[model samples]
Target chain A: MSAGTDTRSVTRQVRPGESPAGPAAGPGKTPFSARLRRDWPLLVMAAPMLLLVTAFWWIPALGNVIAFQDYNPFTGGILGSPIIGFTNFAELFGDPQFLRAVVNTLGITAFQLVFYFPVPIALALLLNSVVSGKLRAFIQGVVYLPHFFSWVLVVAIFQQMFGGAGLIAQILRDHGYSGIDWMTNSDTFILLVTAETVWKDAGWGTIVFLAALSTIDQNLYEAAAVDGARRWRRMWHITLPGLRPVIVLLLILRLGDALNVGFEQFMLQRSAVGSKVSEVFDTFVYWSGLRTGDFGYGAAAGLFKGLVGLVLILVANKVAHALGERGVYSRS
Target chain B: MSRKKVSGLAPWEEPGSVAGRIGKGGVLALIVLAVLLPLYTIVLTSLSPAETVNRVGGLVLVPDGITFDAYRQIFSDSVVSRAVLVSTGVTLVGTAISLGVSVLGAYALSRPGTLFHRPMLFCVLLMFVFFPGLIPTYLMVTSLGLKDSYWSLILPSAVSAFNVVVLRAFFMNIPHELLDSARIDGAGEFRILWRIVLPLSKAVTAVIGLFYAVGYWNAWFNAMLYIDDTRKWPLALVLRSYVVDSNPLPTATVGVNGFGHVAPPTLAIKMAIVSIAVLPALLIYPFVQRHFTKGVIIGAIKG
Candidate 1:
């Protein structure tokens, strides 16, 4: 297979793209046509990805202009619809349900940041403390298994544990108490979702912290000990600081993703818990737009989410850069 | 947590406290149980007789007479059998397409001096922040006549910006010296990528391949969004309908053993569905677990 390419490649200079040494020499100095001649293969390689992104992402982003129109899918379509600029946004803000969704979405994001974010760090610390590498690896394997499970499967497994007539309910009944259904209760719905999120994802979250932990210089701990610093001192001074960069980066990502609080989890449970508790941003768009056929209204909500998310991500990335860390993307 | 001989504490480390170690062991045990106990009941309930499931009330704890009756019923059910095939086909095709496009694109972006590298990288990185709203994408799909088509599931979500970034990072970390030598040997970029780069990247490639495959296998929302045809539903969607929606499966298909009179419990049948949905993830996890520690950690740390 390689020999087939050797025939055409044998005599052609191919320019080698960049020499190994001083490879950072910017191609910006090269003329576009010359670079094109030398690097057409790379362009060919990237075409499919560029095409897919343009089709699905950029086009649909432009398509959000339907949000400003009084759209009818059948009659007006996207273009023929009469422009009612900002009317959809106006109505969206005025609607109490939309407001509730914003509140709920922010609430979930905040709640998870407080309660769920530290779990993997704590778990990693615990796992890292274990002296037996074999036991640690085994535990890590078992815990990370849940991250691979489909949300549908995760919910089913949770239902078997927390639903009416589920194991906990059964245990309560066996003890002569009438048990409450955990899955359907609107009051503690936040707790339930948090627990479910932790179960499904907290283990996976540990991987980054574990990686960070491994990178921390062990010699610092020895140095600290020789200076008469205790275990708590070593952890407080050395460990947490070492983890700060990764922690900051992840926290920034969580902020950027604040609006998207697990659409499928909320969608699957909407009927059971009522939309009042379950209507986060994504689910709200899905129900209002897709289910009610209010394409314009839904698109407005979606565009609201996308624009706000972009702003948040940009702001967060700026903060990261100020704090001497790379955020979501580099300026390069 | 196990009581095997632990490595002696390093001189810098404080003497281990017995109570703290015991507490850690207990907590770790609970975490493991929290995962395994649910899995145990689901699997056991699927295997148990009707009386055993009924006696336990809903989810079985202790085992009783084991049987393949539930599995037999699930396999024989036409809807489920068809769904399994659909899920398998979609996963295989989707993974291949994603891996191919992502690998090529990532390699392109990996090379620093290549034409349009910055523009291509920008195109991908832009996806990270500005997720176009779901409605327009849906509109685009419908307008393009992809409604109810399997292509709808594969095309729209095929190129993940994160995966592209991760794969690009991995490719860049490859010793450029290796590729330069191949280039000097008159190997074209394609040949170098095929013969040199890919052979060295088996672990990370397999890891990325598994990630895409799992995403495809576990995706139900796309199917729900685009597929109006029940016949085209993947296993994940089918699992959702039966388990989350708690819809009764076709009576003729469920709750009956191949032999006439031995009716397995409905709970067993539901548990059976859950098992079928979950089993693949569990089976594939151990093999991929090492890659998570290696591939995902390195990618994450680098980012």
Candidate 2:
């Protein structure tokens, strides 16, 4: 009886997603081909969708194969191109701008992770503590507005506020003080970009933390209060501990994405400041390929960046698992 | 989970300290004021007359005098106006396409243990971590002859992996029993998705759809990268040229409006352009406000 059951289960394992594969199904049941036959309409339903994704997403993904070739938009397609065999990679590594780009990308990511990461947590705590729901809602609306604005508009707003002919400069000139060049200043460009990111996104980031905070059983707070814990103590012990898992999860995710480091923001600013401090991987791709028309080299450089980011995410997710947090990719 | 059972000490409890309450109110007021001030300045500048704008040294905290000339010029049948229309069309079409693709894709992936499900899920997840970068993407678009085409804008961003993940999580949250019963009744995957999942998941669908719409609306980066035709240019890119680069008149030559009116100053035109770019999103936002909060919160947590 045991041997017969094992054969049935093995067949089910081999042909997954069928009725016979169901754990509850009896061993005496015929195969799930009949069930699948009835579900052909279901297969038909998924066909167009499968085709769409396969063509647009999967096919183009294969186009990344040009990273190894001497790709030319005018002359050769991804396949027809001559394989340069890591020559593009070699040229990329030797380029001074490439090195600068890597450093700049990492540097910006580090600064933002330090400065911008905790802001939403703090904002959520403040919002949670606020007594007036109306006031809190209004503030939430106001703060979230910036996140919806495009990077172009955000950068424009920054320029209007701080650019050479902007209001701040005019105010300073009226006071006989020198207009500070925040936009084009290479030294302060990183800070300016980071600040802009925070202004645009900090409020939006609060949504998850706020959601998690709201789920913190109110009774937990009450229980702490009953223990004579003051508001701050309750926040420190009950609230902070409740937010712990979320914080860890978000931190892991952020680390995984640490290499991204705000592509559009950097790209928009690159032209104004020149490429000294502004050169990052994305910009490098644009300048090298689109601007200079070196498609193969640019493809190789981009591929390199993607590979590094993938490694980071995988490692970070693995670390999260080891630490016993629910990482992004669960084993199940 | 009962709301009535969850009642607790009210926030307006007898003030633990009089000074503390006063301080809290003061701080709140200050924050409100600070946030409003920059937005006020932008609105005032946009509304102020050109003469007043100049007189105020572009620091018009309050409008010296109000005029809609800036708004008028933007809305008039100029290059700016055409760009606005182009942007509107692209955003609407792109958002619809993206949401449709993402909804179908997310539904399929959310089904655990379906044939080809895990591999496809892994593929989507890989796209998130390893962005194939700009050059390869650009090459692909160019090679496909999509450069300068509207598809350049719509196709590249049609299925954002982040949106897929969020929608999948939402699909996952739908009780398994409903799906089981539907399957037993011989409802096809798409039938079950449309009849059962889609109806129940409207909040998330609306929210994710809005996000795609907003992204498409706000997308100037792709335009900057791929689009070369000035006639096909979107409002945001046009705004960039006017506001960021301080470029003159943007191909209207003052004649595109048909009255042959002379172009305004670089600043006035720039402010006008900025207002044009921001106005639509602002208008459309209120309609989606109800779904916005819950949708965004769920999306973020899932992400």
Candidate 3:
């Protein structure tokens, strides 16, 4: 509450040490000794979120301990289960379905990086070239709308357009051709999913690139023009360089999330295409854990996924810093 | 990388540049048309009569034949009507609760000094990069006895890490000078948050709130995974059944048109289902799009 003394000691831990940032640090910026005043209202304000995270996020994180145990939800609690050491990991590696999921996850991620990642940059460039603000904004709005649509709606929309009974198939049948099984065809499922991801997300993904482009000084373009640089040359040398930081930043972030090939997207369509096409780490856990009621085994796979993601983020962040670009986890 | 090469000299070469402008404009127009044409066709197909739709069979590209019969049939069923009501309830209630909880937490994090602020921030960030996977979360929800209830939809998704981070970044942009002034005016942190911070943050709040609302509205997988009760189904799940399973006709007690007969799965029915699911988001999205650039990009840049 603002009713307290306005001065507080700024003896904050720039490093991890000393007292945590709390309402106890008196209201004035002063020496550390006189700062032990409790601010109840501030603590009260911070309580709900902390409680929610601790309950939902932290508790579930702690539940990952089940991965190392022969845990039974019906019998022993998460921590009280018998320890099985590395057997879960051993089992996970030995399972063919799990191996398939690993390969499938990597395969989809690589395909997306190659296919879906660059279109947004091209789109941003096209948008930047459009001199009309109204038109650009309208198009941006139209494209970005799909990002807000849930995976359910997106999958439904795709099915309505391309499924065996969908419009395209209906058209093909009318034209004396066989109805194409685009949705259910396992061979083409990865491409279909990647295309859907682009359609739903690429437009929203352009925002950062556009923001970066907008920040580039217009005078540089004028100078390029004065130097008799062609439009294509100007774009190649100046525009692309201007967008480099954002591109690198986004790439690093994307690498950090490379394994997260989305859950709801794969889940809804997995039944249609069957596991051969749709099985990924997230859905694998969902099915094995919930459907088959193997909570401990699923938790082990999930814990493995989390550790991989964390390692990716950390490694990618370090790589970015080494390359002299600010990663998602900048020191600041 | 193979890039398309420009055919002619730069447009600025020729004065009046009319031909060059027309060429580029023509290409852009065609691109826009290609993108918009499918959406237009879907809407037209949804609007046309069932008989007309079946006759067309594929897509009614032009709107020459049109009727509201499909829309009428879609809204007529109690199952669909109830699902719409439930979806609306969940989205509105869920977004409000999510925003309230996230704003409180984010505001706390944005403040310079709060107990365990850095650790709290780190925890939130950890939620973004490393997830607790579906099994444990499903187990947690089930253990909490929320399986068949609307609370299952509302509570589990009430805290989106991305939205919280975005809002926290937005809140941090608030000048410390303003907080200093508010403190001098004898206002509590809550008063400052409610009166000063929130008033200044309408754009981000509205955009993030819209994101949450759309998320809840479009959520079907969670309901499919956790919700077993047909009565509490959302429009998205209903649409999924219609689209994926291709069954327009309602089950058992519910009648399609208050008759004992079941309507066949027509293109019109499928389109109508998609149209219904998309309507809310399409209608509401433009208003929120204005806030999106500033609201989202700032967060991404900072993060």
Candidate 4:
């Protein structure tokens, strides 16, 4: 890919109609034809990625038209399928399983927001307070290790420690208590998954907050301390306020990603706990739509999730701006 | 409180009182223990003898005896060995291709006033807001004749817009005068990129490459969705089936004919598989650990 781009750029520069003088191109006022001639090499460099993104990202986006069609893969996919405006969505809305999935997604997302979100902030604060740099780095390294492990490995680790025949269960059994099926327990599965997420990601998440914390001016803390402010007072008045924008930015991003309550995690555990308790929107779309050959319905469910996420992000960004914070992207 | 000067402490930081020191120590100890204990159990259990593992009922925290039987059994099994090869191949090839495409695209996009620059930037940034739903993406993959192919795993996720954006930001930060000097010397865009831009941005490129490699290595979802043939499955998918899903490892038919009758303890095998899945990440983690904060901060703050 690199060689191809390199060759193309070199070849383009050697072509006719080349103006060798640099910056005399008059910036944005350059003629479109002249700019194209001069900059075609850059365009050539970008072509492969442009083609890939268009083919994969944009085409699939257009394929969302399947949600409005009774899409049968055998019947020529989206374009070939009969039009069924809102029927798939109506079915999705009417389906109890789909509703269950929506509820489960919301529940898991809420649990994560409430329980898992603050962990990194707390960890960052704790680590920030540490006087010894080496000790802090060591702790960060150890904690961050789990974040790289796949959900499969993480789930396996959790099962080994907590499953019916796992370490904890064996200890209980040895103490004359019956083993509990913690791994597959539906009633507590949400908690289990959330705990797993925290274990896997909390330490990794602290990196950004730690960065943000370090950027907080030392003079602010010094100024506060000069006024006879205590540690807790400084934290509340200076530290917390400094972290507020980042916290809000992350929170908004989290809300936008709420619909994605981890498909693979739930999919791997679904048969163990049964989908009745484990069905989040992603899994629901997979099982009901793709697996069952109900492509249109699955497309509708996924489309709904995506649209909600898009709206959530937009609203969150708007809210961030209202609060005088820079959201994810600027309007410009 | 005496306003005593303290060396090596920040202005707002307390010189640890005895109670405060003890409290910090306790918290750090808990954090360390929470992470280390589970890892210890996994390693110990993988090394423990079958009888010891069975005797303990599951994960062995304290091994009475050690054995490599589980590891030996898994490697000797064709399914697992093949899956390992598949994963390594996919990760290497996928990372290389992803990095190549990303570098080219990022370099181009980083240059201000390049043809279609704003629209291209807008398109990539818009990826942050919405994703094409699962079914459509799957359909697109199938329609492209990539279904059941390894390309399905690599292609769909080949270009991460975030990585491109991050790399673009890094490339843009490169001084224009350096590139202009090269350009004045008749060095083309490609030559300047190869000799100057790449060498200068090695750290960010490496970080982005690692991200791509990790993503590919850890991905089983694409395989699960695309590849139907069990033989073509990657190590992660196999690991998920045998370990996470609690399914028994498929008995090897060729190498150890009588091994089916006397299999290792299920728990030991599961632990071994778990360890195997995590081993690569653990091995490479230390080398890349320092870059995590640097790379992530660049992406987060800039993007």
Candidate 5:
């Protein structure tokens, strides 16, 4: 739906999440039982969702207390697991594989922030600058194709192109070039993953900026051009400023999720590149905990990731504040 | 679907240098080609007959001949066939469950004056910020006796908070007067939602539904965690084992011809499996793509 034009609703819309219902429901305290009786149908509607969320997300979230215990699902499961405070954490911090996972995760995150972040904005601008709406739409559709491909398929496609027996290797062999398989090359692993991310998501990423670009008043561009400003100057002054709010919001989100480069991308490629280069936090948890039956230790590793994520959220909030803007979680 | 456009550029914009136009065209062409060429090759490879694959001795790059033997072989293979059934069933059932719960729950919270609305919204919002660790979820699934069951694949991921919020945003945008009028006519909340709100919000609902459907279709990790039986493996897990793990399925290792036929080249069969995994997304995505930007813009505004 288009944004409302009413002045009263415009002010009210800013706090819709926190606001009482519109004029239909007045803001007055009522006894719980009375309201419950009146809203029983609505309560029934919400029951299933509440039940599912509790079972899966909230319960499992609390069950991370197993990270502190020596968990044996056969013995007592989450209920009676032996609590050995900090033992799993001790083991987690001490383990070389876990260390590698942390380092690799952060390294990839920082690398992607630098290399992969701007690509969508630039591509969106390029697409925006195109002169034919049909061509632009076709290009948009084509590029978003890979985002829908499951990571397994993405890796498979990448393997077909860059694996030892893949097209590139075959071409190189035809020219008598010795041994080149980019998929397994540890030295370029970061770049390889970054390329995969760009190929798969960069187009999909443009959707938000494209929406923002649409919101930018066309008059600003016209006025700037009328002032004898060339294209580059108009883009820098008007277009970039117009895009600032969205850019900041996404950046803050990207920071809060900084450690998550995604699991499937790394997990699928781990065998080819070896754990030494490919073991990220999620994969580390999967391999070390699930495969080896070290549930508590794996839970500890996963919990540590969550803790770091929380810290990142704080740092993101600080950045948001410094920019004189709302952070990721506020003003909802 | 649209009238031919003279230009996407605005009137105030110059035509720009010829080189700039060409460079932009060149880059856009390359981006489109990069996406399509790999897909083109895979589809070609999947269709290539044995001799053509043997001639190429790798991924088929050029089309010399065509056959559906690879698809026929995989379909005949019990493992791939079973997996396909599982994937399709899960996707449909999971999407329905997710969309059902999300719609009911979103409408419940859509009215801000509803009981427990703030707390419920806060609870759902927590999903974005916190993830239950993988081991705990596995343990919970097992404890619930859902391990190795089809329900395990569906239930754990049944609700998407983002979808719920987006739906709620759309629902709240619907004029409250309609609901009030329905209530005045003695229409209950359920009837109001069913008869009034749903028909108006079909596009957002479809977008959210597709999201759940695609997620379920592509899901493998949950299956890998919970399903120990190869018989229960979904198409994605099967794809992973066959292609990414390079493990051969029984059918892919044998010929589908009536008698004494050599198996299709592994490359062709592998590409065939890849093609099968990718085909659904390719088919369903374009129809839903245009509707999604609105869904996203709403989320951006509401979030």
Candidate 6:
């Protein structure tokens, strides 16, 4: 994603009169002061953004140093704190609660990958197949509505419809059947969360896939039809192949984000199902770091998760490159 | 149902066998029902009379009578009313600041050969891979003494890197010849950006602005983390605490004059809060829905 955007702009920068050597090479050709004079307006425009990013993004990044320190709010600041090396990490790996959180995180991620990932692809195909524009638009709007809702709202809606005293339970009681405890059931917590996620995002997620489907050459489908390809066969061959690159790109991105199985969703429902089931890395970090005031320990767990995410993204990008696709970033 | 001829149906697309048509129709119906049923229930329950809501014991599927008591009660409450104001203020201010920063930065970064452009773009893109984890971010906010301030919410998320990249992509796609001609005609970069680029990029800018607004509106976590003062909380956070946390509505002491007679059911109140939280998005969504696909697709395909 990053590399693709950069390369486009880089190519665009190559003017007719300019040297073939790009902007990076231009620094050597022209004097620094001369270039600065010419680029001052753009620099001035970007200054606020640069300052904001430096404060929010870069400074917090530097604050990751606390992960390696015995961080205390009262006495030692981030850098002033005594270095603790990987002791916090060692403690994190040793803690049963942390292990449980890890297991839960992976479990949710895996479930989402298996069950939730293909849903949007399937939904997009279904929407794509609809010949009626009005029906398609209506369905699209309805589905996308849930995506705009906050997780708290989504969970509340689920509870309203499925909780012990919820609509479904009330209906079942009217028919002399007992109400089910699906909403607060720890055993089914993972499945419930996954279902909620699908309900919320599956339709919205189809936007990109649908866009990809639209870009497929219509002539290929017509030619396939002339060659006697059935609807199912055409979809399997022509349509699926056309969507493969996007599917791969999305898959890599999903894998990179596999560990972040949402904080708010789990946090909101944690009391209902208990932390034993609902606790994930994000909530775990929150509980240990902020809520419990174990900043160093929580920072360590968070840092560990961040590092894993970075490595996963890099590895995913490398795999994408091996598959002859541009990953998130290019080497250039 | 009458079968209307479908436009944009490819020549290769079959009319489909009877079974296939029925199957597709059934699946589509199921998908639509899955989405609409919960929304219907929420709205119905919110509007249902207290007696009907009590009888239902949860969400009212069918309304015996309509009552705006729940809405009146919630709106009249000091806490909720204050929360609404906070949310509105945060969303408007945050969106404006975000749009301003994003527009200026995107324009600067869009021109590739500008000094520090490559490095700035690289810095922005790095956000895609590495996140400064939650603890440090919280520490930073606290250390900066923005722990209880609204600026904490606005500042932390002031500039979305994805939006910036997407906006830059849109800027880059603006015909260079037009910009060049304007430049030759003595129009400065700012003038060209404001007068020409922004005017032409209305669709994209509007969509990105909507995205920022929605994000700010739906945001509760930042407020929950930073703003320890309950009165300063936004609607989403209030909604979460009141509805999801199942806290009883802090009875309105001041504005309960007319609402005192009609004691709405708990379910009705919960649904009403949910509706209030969602109402703004639903109101503006139709107007902006068309741009959703265009905006997201551009970002996905290019960025």
TM-score of every prediction relative to native: 0.93, 0.87, 0.88, 0.91, 0.93, 0.93
Worst 10 residues of 2 chain B by lDDT: B1-10
**Cα lDDT listed for each candidate:** 0.80, 0.71, 0.72, 0.79, 0.80, 0.81
lDDT of 6: 0.81
**RMSD, every candidate, angstroms:** 6.4, 7.5, 6.7, 6.4, 4.3, 3.9
Name every residue pair that clashes in candidate 3. Answer: A2-B188, A7-A27, A7-A28, A7-A29, A8-A27, A8-A28, A8-A29, A21-B114, A21-B115
Task: Indicate the docking level reached by candidate 1.
Answer: medium
Stretches of candidate 1 off by over 4 Å are A1-25, A326-332, B1-5, B252-258
Q: Which prediction has the highest DockQ against the true structure?
A: 1
The clash numbers for all candidates, in the given order, read 0, 0, 9, 0, 1, 1
Runs of candidate 6 with Cα error greater than 4 angstroms are: A1-25, A324-332, B6-12, B252-260, B299-303
True contacts kept of 3: 0.39
Q: Which residue window of length 10 is worst by lDDT in model 4 chain A?
A: A1-10
Model 5 agreement with the true structure over A13-109: per-residue lDDT tens digits: 3343544443224436767777777778888999999999999989899999999999888888777988999988988888999889889988998
Can you tell me which runs of candidate 5 are displaced by over 4 Å?
A1-19, A22-28, A314-332, B1-8, B254-256, B259-261, B298-303
lDDT of 6 by residue, A198-303 (tens): 9888888887778778878888889999999998899999899877876776676667677878888998999999999999999999999999998999999998
Comparing 1 with 3 on lDDT, the higher-scoring candidate is 1
The worst-scoring run of ten residues by lDDT in candidate 1 chain B lies at B252-261
Order of candidate numbers by DockQ, starting with the best: 1, 5, 6, 4, 3, 2
Give the worst 10-residue stretch by lDDT in candidate 4 chain B.
Answer: B252-261
Q: Find the 10 residues in a row with the least total lDDT in model 6 chain B.
A: B252-261
Query: How does model 2 score by TM-score?
Result: 0.87
- Calculate each model's fnat, 2 decimals: 0.69, 0.33, 0.39, 0.61, 0.62, 0.59
lDDT of 2 at B7: 38
Residue A55 lDDT in candidate 2: 51
Error of 1 at B273 (Å): 0.9
On TM-score, who's better, 1 or 3?
1
- Candidate 3 segments whose C-alpha is farther than 4 A from its true place: A1-38, A324-332, B1-27, B251-265, B299-303
